[model samples]
Target: MGKLVDGIWQQAGYDTDNNEGRFVRWDSSFRDSVETDPDARYPAEPGRYRLYVSLACPWAHRTLIVRALKGLEEAIPVSIVDPYMGEQGWSFSDGRDCIPDPLFGARHLHELYVRAKPDYSGRVTVPVLWDRRHGSIVNNESADLLRMLNRAFDAYANRDLHDLYPAERREQIDAVNARVYDQVNNGVYKAGFASTQAAYDEAVGELFCALDWLETHLKGRDWLVGEQLSEADIRLFTTLIRFDAVYHGHFKCNLRRIKDYARLEAYLERLYAIPQIGSTVNFRHIKQHYYSSHRQINPSGIVPAGPILPFL
Candidate 1:
């Protein structure tokens, strides 16, 4: 809900008014790549990278999924912030399931952004790929980080970890990604943060339309892209896994629950059954962060406990 302007932490810095009640997400400013070149900035190393993520955030969740699928947990460490994001934004507290910032010992996530670039100006969002060697962020964009984690560090990753983004199927994967990103991935936010009835209607319509397409598309297919698992499935899985839990209620995206879609429900279960994939899901953090952090939406900050998880 806020951003950094010229390295200063400005609370509630985002303004969606210009879009005529549409909630437009700001672009992530920290964009660098981690390559496996022998002579490149932020070269791939076993312990040279770390991630700052919130289990609640779907964008951040993307990286976590890849890290697990590729077996990069031991190679690249991660620090989780508190779920209850108040005026101070994401902070590293000694709360349950929250891993404190051990690298910089910063109290908040913003400190790491500033540490990377003193005059940084943008939203402080995660799954930040921090380069311990450069003392800066290699990349903050979740989509980019997914690819990086899939291949860039394959040397350090487990030998059996299959490539989620294979070179041959990239075109198809990118196509699925484009549709999912605009419609379902970010459409939930657009609907939840809409300021007017028209904007809300537009967003909710788009969200459901996308879901409808996915429901049909996944009828006979187990994965989003080709015969095997790909980046597209990882991208859509984060949103689907959180749909009924948070998006359906908190975000007012209640046109239909993921359970209502026969194939989608089965597909969700299949993905969750993957080894280590379930560990990335923290409903407590997901529910609290959405219901509490967005005070404008849920003023009382009361997190719902019902609609039992069917993730397994």
Candidate 2:
């Protein structure tokens, strides 16, 4: 929740009040690439890059889903941070399904950020693409990493895997992604982390509006765009999965649950049923992180045990 100021870790955690009651996410600092082109600074190569992620994070979860779906587990290895992010921020403490940093043996995620850029000033985020040889981050933006994983490793991925973002349907996919990103994906955060009632109401209104549209659009369709599962679906899937678990209660986005929309709930189950999709989900980590990390929302730090997921 905390961020580094000129490579120095600051304990001043998530500042929602600074945005005038709006929860605006900080822009990702590292935006390099690992393309397939041979002349690229970070060429797509097996074993050259590793991912540092938190399973609790939806952004990071999307990248993991792409990795698993593409069957690139052998190509790119991952190191997971401890789910419970505290004042020190994301750490490498041993926990269920957590993989500690063996590359630099760093205790904190910010240490790795400082290691890459000595004077980096931004929130040290998860789903970090680390270049082993360059000894720096290739990219930290989850959306960027999602596209990178979708196609950059085609030569190394499983033969049975299909392209999530087909060239012909990219326009449609991007269009769908734009609306979903604003009103659905990041919208819940706006509602949950809002400091003012107006902000909360506005965000929640847009969120449910977007959900209503999706419920109507997906009436006779199998995916978000085109005839196949595209990147649009992956982007929204991460957010939808966490809606009831945390957003509904903790984030104050309780107007209507995902379960309230029959299509969305069924669509969620259909996506979850996909091979390797369920493996990417760690409900314990997901639930614990939100209910515990955001002290501003749930000060008591008491996590609920019910409102159970039907699919699980």
Candidate 3:
């Protein structure tokens, strides 16, 4: 993976050496929001915003789940990038499941970032909320986009049936999100991208510990918070769905598979059974991206064929 320096694409990978082999994720640069008020800078207008995403990215996957769950497919269109991230980073291709950028017809994702801010300097990551009206990026942070998409388009959403982030359960959901984000959602990356044995062991230990805690917490519950699915569940779902299929083997996070945790496995199946939720998962893209993109971990650049998901 690479980043843009002063709007110039640079082939630079993570600097785990300086941080004692820890895989530290860079902060998302764009943090604007889409509000419901018409006068707002980024009002939630149907057809005014476009989402740039990668089906392979878990962060980008979260936004896709929320968009589907809220039934905003037509309201907010999406353009998916090629799964196999080469040296040029995420790009548009005639490859299966790829969608070219309709507005600028840009070849690479960073081109759009350059269009948004000529001298923008950071890792050009997804899911990017592009404001078609302003011809600029609204936001690139998935956490922000999750909440933004959750309610911003309620007026236009086909299934504004339920609030994923309800007022009453916000506290609980945020708390759950914090732990899961640290030890679970991003824990797998910490373990996988770690350069040192100590870093990997520490990350793996926390990951399994968090998984064990989740198993206990979900003993007689259907969701992570409240009685219904919340942002907490959605955030964790993206990571859990990829655990056995990718993380276990590719990332060397093989302490135990999600299938081994009876409750988590069942919980995963239950969530995956939801049509909107299940459709967001693309195992082929997920596998190919991790195995091929992170060439440092898997120098052979070969995607695995086994460890079939039972839920599928």
Which consecutive 10 residues in model 2 have the weakest lDDT in total? 11-20
| Positional deviation of residue 13's Cα in model 2 after best superposition, in angstroms | 3.2
lDDT of 1: 0.88
Candidate 2: tens digits of C-alpha lDDT, residues 131-179: 9989999899999999899889888997567888888998998899999
Error of 1 at 10 (Å): 1.3
Give candidate 1 regions above 4 Å deviation.
Answer: none
CA lDDT of each prediction against the hidden true structure: 0.88, 0.90, 0.93
Candidate 3 structure quality by residue, lDDT tens digits, 78-127: 99999989888999887888899989889999999999999999898989
Clashes of each: 0, 0, 0
For model 1 the TM-score comes to 0.97
- Candidate 2 — what's its lDDT? 0.90
Clashing pairs in 2: none
Candidate 3 Cα errors over 4 Å, as ranges: none
> What value does the lDDT take at residue 157 in candidate 2?
92
State every prediction's TM-score relative to the real structure.
Answer: 0.97, 0.98, 0.99
Q: For model 1, how does the per-residue alpha-carbon lDDT over 52-93 read when each residue is reduced to its tens digit?
A: 999999999999998988888899999999998867678899
* Candidate number achieving the greatest lDDT relative to the actual structure: 3
